[model samples]
Target: MSQEGWEASSMVSLAAWLEKHKEQLIATAVQQLSDREPLRQHAAGPVRWFFDSLITAIKDNQQERLETILRHWVSMCRIPIDGEPVGLLPVLGVFKRALWARLQANPPDENPLEFAVQLDTVIGQAAEFLSKVEAAALLDEMSHRLTAQAQTSAALANSTKDHFVSVAAHELKTPLTVIEGYSNMLKMELPEATNPRAALMVQGIESGISRLRGLIEDLIDVSLIEMSLLNLELQPVWLRRLLDIAAFEAGDTVKQRKLILDVKRDTFPAQPIIGDPERLLQAIQKILANAIKYTPDGGRIAVAAREINKFIDITITDSGIGIAPENLDRIFEKFSVVGDLGLHSSGKTKFKGGGAGLGLVIAKGIVEAHGGTIWAASPGYDEEQCPGSAFHMMLPLRDVKSGEGMAPAVATAIGSLANAVLERDSVEKSPQKATSEAPAESEQKETPLPVPVVPSKNDHNKDQTKKGGTEGGEKS
Candidate 1:
C-alpha cells in the first residue's frame, strides 16, 4: 500500500467515479444506518462535500490534505448530528460496494488490483475520520443531557419547597384567625384603663399576632405567585384611594415615629385606574411599610403620585438607611436580606426593624403582572447621615393592549372619533322637546348617524388611512 504503487491516473479515475455517483452514495449511506432518522435531506450537503474533498485529497497525496477536508465536514454536520447516522462504517461500505462493482463490470486500463487498493485505502481513511467525529458527538450529547437533568432536578426541588410553604401557611392561617378573634374578645371584655397591665399585655399580643399574620400572608402570596394562581379582582381603583389605605395601614407606625407624611396626589379628583384594588393597596402598603421600618425616628417620608404620559409614578421617598450597593440588584428576590452594614460601618448608626424580606418581592410580582415595573434607588448604604431610599412603582395609566400604542396621527384620529361620539350623545341629551311625536312615514325617512371616516391607504405606508370608519363604510 505504498503511495507510489497507487498510480495518480488510477486515483483520478476513482475520484471521478465517486463524483458521478455522489447522490446515490449519500442515499445508500443513510439507508445503511440501523438507528437513525431518514436523513436523506441532511445527508446531501455532507455527502457532496465528502466526495469533493476526497477527490482533492487523492489528487494531492504529497501532503495530508484529507485531514483538513474531514475536519471541515465534521464541523458542518455536527450541529445537526442528532438525526445523522452513527454507523459510518456501513455507509463507507457503500463506496466499497460501488468500487468493486464498477471494477468487475468494466475493468480499469491501469491494473485493476492496484487501482482498487488505492481507492480502498482512501475509503478506509474516510471511515476512520467519520468514526472519530461520531465519538465526539456522543460525548457532546451526553454532556447536554447531564446539564438538562441537573436543571430539571433543581426546578423540581424548588416546586416541592413552594408546595410545602403553601400547605403550612394555609394550615396555620386557621389558628391565627382564632387567636385574632380571642384577642379582640379580650379587648372588648376588659376596659382599656381599668387594668393598665392587662391592656398593655393585650396590645403586645395584638402586635405580635399582626406581625405573624403579615409573614403568613407573604408566604401565601409567594406560593400563589410561584404556582401562577395569583389572580386579580380587576376594577377601576382610585390611585389616591389605594395610597390612602396604605397610609392608614402604616398610621400607628407613622405616629409612633413622628414621620412627616408628604402626600402629593394627582390634581384631578377621582383619578381612577383599572386594577385589583386590594392587591394593589397591599403592594403600596408593603413598600411604605418597608420605608417606615428601616427609616429612623421622625424621618420624613414623602409619598407622591404624578401623571407621566401613559404611566403614573407612585414614588415613596424616605430619609432612612438606604439599601446596600451589592444587594440592590437582587432586592426583589424572594426572602432576600442584607446584613446590617451600618453596624460594621463606624460612622453610620444601625438601621431599625427587621422583616421576612418578602414584601418587596411580592410587590414586584404584583406590579409586573399589572404590566408595570417596580424599582428602588438609593444614594448608598450608610454612606451619609441619612442615605435615603426612593421606591418607584411605575404603572400604566390605562391598559396596554396590543396596537394601542400608535403614532401621533393615529392617536389623534382616535381622539377625534371619540369626541364625535361624545358630541352625538350631547346633542341627544339636550332637552329638545317636540310638540308631537314624528309620524311613522317621517321617522322612516330619518338620516342615519354619522361615523368618523378613515382615509384610503397609500402604497408606501399602509398605516396611513383615508377618512373612513374603523369598521369601514360608516359601520355598515
Candidate 2:
C-alpha cells in the first residue's frame, strides 16, 4: 500500500482518536495490567512513553519511528521486575483488549473494520519484536551461567586431587621409613664376607626400598607443586657446584650403562648466582637422569654451560632415542609418557624405562620458581637411527647483594607460621632469651658455605689403587 493512503486515512484517524481519548486509553490499560502481579509491579513511565511514541509515529506517518518505539518497549521488557520477566503476553493482551474495547464502543466514521484491522496489525508487529528479543536474552543468560559453573567444577576437582595426593604420600612415608630402617639393619648383620648370597638378597631389598623412597618423594613434590607451595632457599651458589653434585650422584649409573658423561667445566664462568642450591641440583639431576634413561648403552651424553647476557644456559644432550615433534611440549606435563605405555619398564637408567613421569614436571616447577625457563629440542624420534634430544635450561644470573634478587619469602616454609608466632610471643615474654639467641656483633657478618670439591674422572681408579696399596702393605 502507498504510505500516504495508509497514513492519511487509517493512521490519521487513529492518531486523532488516541489524542482525544488518551487518558481513557491509559486508564483502561492500567486497570487491565493491575490484574497481573508481574506487569502491575513495573513502573508506569515506560508504559506512558510507549503510547506517546506510538501516537507521534502515527501522526508523522513514519513506520521507522514506529519500529523504534516498539524496540524501546522491548528493551524495557528485558529488565526483571521481581527477579522474573514482566510477561510480554500479558502486557500485549492488556493493550489489545483496551484498544479493541474502545474501537467497538465507538466505531470510527470511515471504515471502522479497516481501522480495527490496522490496529491488530500494529499489535501483532509488537508481539513479534518482543518474542525475538526475549529469546536472545534468555540464551545469553544461560550461556553465562553454564560457563561459570564449568569453571567452578574444574577448580574443585583439581583441589580435591591435590589434597588426596598429599594425604596418601604422608601416610605412605611412615611405613616406608620403618621398612628402610629394618632393611639397613639386615644389611649390617648379614655381612657379604660370610653370607654372600644372602647379602646379595638383602642388597636387592635395599635397592627396592630406595626406589620406593624416591617415588614417594616425587609424589610429595608433585603435591607441593600443584598447591604452589614449593619453597626454595635462595642463596649465593656456584652453578658448577650444583652440576657437579648431580653428575656425581649419577656417576655409578653412567659407569654401569657404559655411557660417556662429558661435563665441560672450562666453559663455566667463575660468577655465582642467587638460587636454591638443593632445588637447582634436583632439577639438573632430573634432566640428567632423563637423558641417561633414553640413551642406549655406551651412548654419549654431554653437559655444557654458556653465558647469555644476564643468564646462564645449561644444555644437556643425549645421543640415544630422540623425541617426536608433537611430544616435546607434552613431555613436561604431569604423568606424561612419550613412548608406548605397554613397553614401559621400571628402571631409572634402563633404555626406554618408564617412570611416574613427574621428574620433568618437578624440574620445570623448580626452574620457573627461580625465574628460569627450560625446554627440549630433537630432530625426531628414531630408536634404530638414534637421533638425539637436547634440553636447555636458562637461569638468571643474580648476585646475592643485587636489588633484583629473589625475596626472602621464596625460602619461607609454609608449616612454620605457628612456630614463628610462638617464638615471637616467647621473645616478648623473655627479652634476655631473645638477646642470647641474637648473633654477637662480631658475628653479624654472614659467611657463605664452603663449596665441596668435585670428583675428577680418574678419582674412581685412584681410590682403587690406594686400596690395593694398603692391602699389599698388610700382606707384607
Candidate 3:
C-alpha cells in the first residue's frame, strides 16, 4: 500500500475506536478530574462536556466543537478552585494524559505511533488556535478587569479601616469611661486604712483599666500609622535622656524578675538629636518592655548606643527565648505574636506570655516616622537552650524627609487621649514620685558588666561568613 493509503486507513481506525469507546473516554476524564481535591466539587459536568465535545470534533474533522469547549474551560479558569486559581493548560493536560493511557491500552491499529501523532496534532492545533483567538482578548480583559477590581477592593478596604477605627474608638471609650468613673467612686469609698483588701481590689481594677487603655492607644496608633496620620513635634532632644527614661521605666520589672538591665551609658552619645521626645520615649519603652516580656527571670538585658555615620544606633540584647529565624522581621508586623496562643500565659511581663502584639509594630512606626530603621537578629528560637536575640534601632541625628505629619485635628485628638491616660495614672502614682523612685530601684538591679556593642555592617558580614553565611536581618 502507498504511504497516503496507510495514513487514511490509520485515521479511519482512530475515528472508529474513539466512537466505539466514547462513554469510556468521557468517564476516564471525569475520574481524573474527580481525583483532584479542588476539581472534585464540580468535576462531572465540565469533564463530560469537554470529552464529548473533543470526541465529536475528532469524528467530524472540524475545530468548532473542540474550540467552544476549550474556550469554556478558559473562561472557567478565571473562577478560583478553593480560593486558588485553576489554569486551562493544567486541566487540558489531564485529559491528554488520560487519552494517551487509553490509546496505549487499546491501540486502534498495528501502527500505534501514527495514531499517537494524530492525537498530538489534534491537541496541538487546538492549543495553537486558542493562542491565536484568546491570547490577545485574555490579556486585554485581564489588564482592564483585574486592575479595576483591585482598585475597587483597595478603596473598600481603606474605607473599612477608617470606619472600623472610628467605631472601635467610640464604642470602647463609652464602657471604659463608665468603668473608670465607678471604680474611682468605689476606691474613694473604701479607704486603704479601713479596708486594705478593698483598696488592693481597686488597684487591680485600675491596673486592668490601664492595660485596656494601652491597648486602645496601640490600636489607634496602628490605624494612624497605616493612614500616615502619626503626629510628631520634631525638636532637638537628647537620646541619652530618652534611653535613661526607658531603662528607668523598666526598673520595676527588672527588680521584680531579679534581671540585670545593663544600660551602657558610656557608649551613648552626649549630643542631642532632632525628634519627638514623648513619641520616641514611647518607642524605646515598648522595645524594652518586649525584651522584658520574653526574657526569663534572672536573665540579662543590655542596652547600648553608638553613633554610626550620621545615625545613632541603639542596640538592645536580651538573654531570652530567641525569635525563630523566619519570625525576626515578622515580629514587627501588627498582631504577629510568636509562640502557641493557647499555651501563652495572660500576664504581659510573664515569660512567653500573650499580648496584642502591637508593641513592635507601633515601635517600628514611630522609629520610621523619625526617618530611621529597626530590625532584630537571633540564633533562632529555643526555649530550653536560650540562645537569645538582639534588636537594633538606627535613628538619624538630623531631620530627614519623612512623609507628611498628622493632620492638626488628628494630632489634637491623639494628644487629648494620651493626656486622659496620664491624668488618670497620676491619681495612683504621681509623676514626680515615679521618676524619683525609678533611679533608686534601677541602681539596685542594674548590673555592672561589659556590654557588647552591636557590630558594624562589615563586621556583621564577616561574622555571617564565618558562621556559614546565614542572613540575620532585613536590609535597612
Instruction: Compare the candidates by TM-score and give the number of the best one.
Output: 2
Global fold similarity of model 3 (TM-score) = 0.56
lDDT of each: 0.67, 0.74, 0.72
Residues 140-210 of candidate 1: C-alpha lDDT, one tens digit per residue: 88999999999999989887877888999999999998999999999988868797888888999998897
lDDT tens per residue, model 3, 31-82: 6655565565567667766666776666665556667766766766443344
Q: Is candidate 1 or candidate 2 better by TM-score?
A: 2
Clashing pairs in 1: 453-467, 453-468, 453-469, 454-466, 454-467, 454-468, 455-465, 455-466, 455-467, 456-466
Off by over 4 Å in 2: 1-42, 45-77, 81-83, 86-112, 118-133, 192-200, 251-264, 293-302, 317-333, 336-340, 375-390, 401-476
Clashes of each: 10, 0, 0
Candidate 2 lDDT, tens digit per residue, 1-476?
A: 12333445678888898887777777777666665565654645566677888889888878777666765666564434444556565677777888889888877888887888887777776667667765776687799999999999988987787788889989999998899899889889989999899899998998888788788888898888877888865545566656566677789999999999999866766555667666777788899999999999999999999889989899999997999999999999988888888886667678778798999999999899888999999999999999999999999887534424444442232124335546666866796865676678887663432232212223323343222211111110
Candidate 2: residue pairs that collide: none
- Stretches off by above 4 angstroms in model 3 are 1-162, 399-476
Rank by lDDT (best first) = 2, 3, 1
Residue 472, candidate 2: Cα error in Å is 35
Ranking by TM-score: 2, 1, 3
- The lDDT of model 2 is 0.74
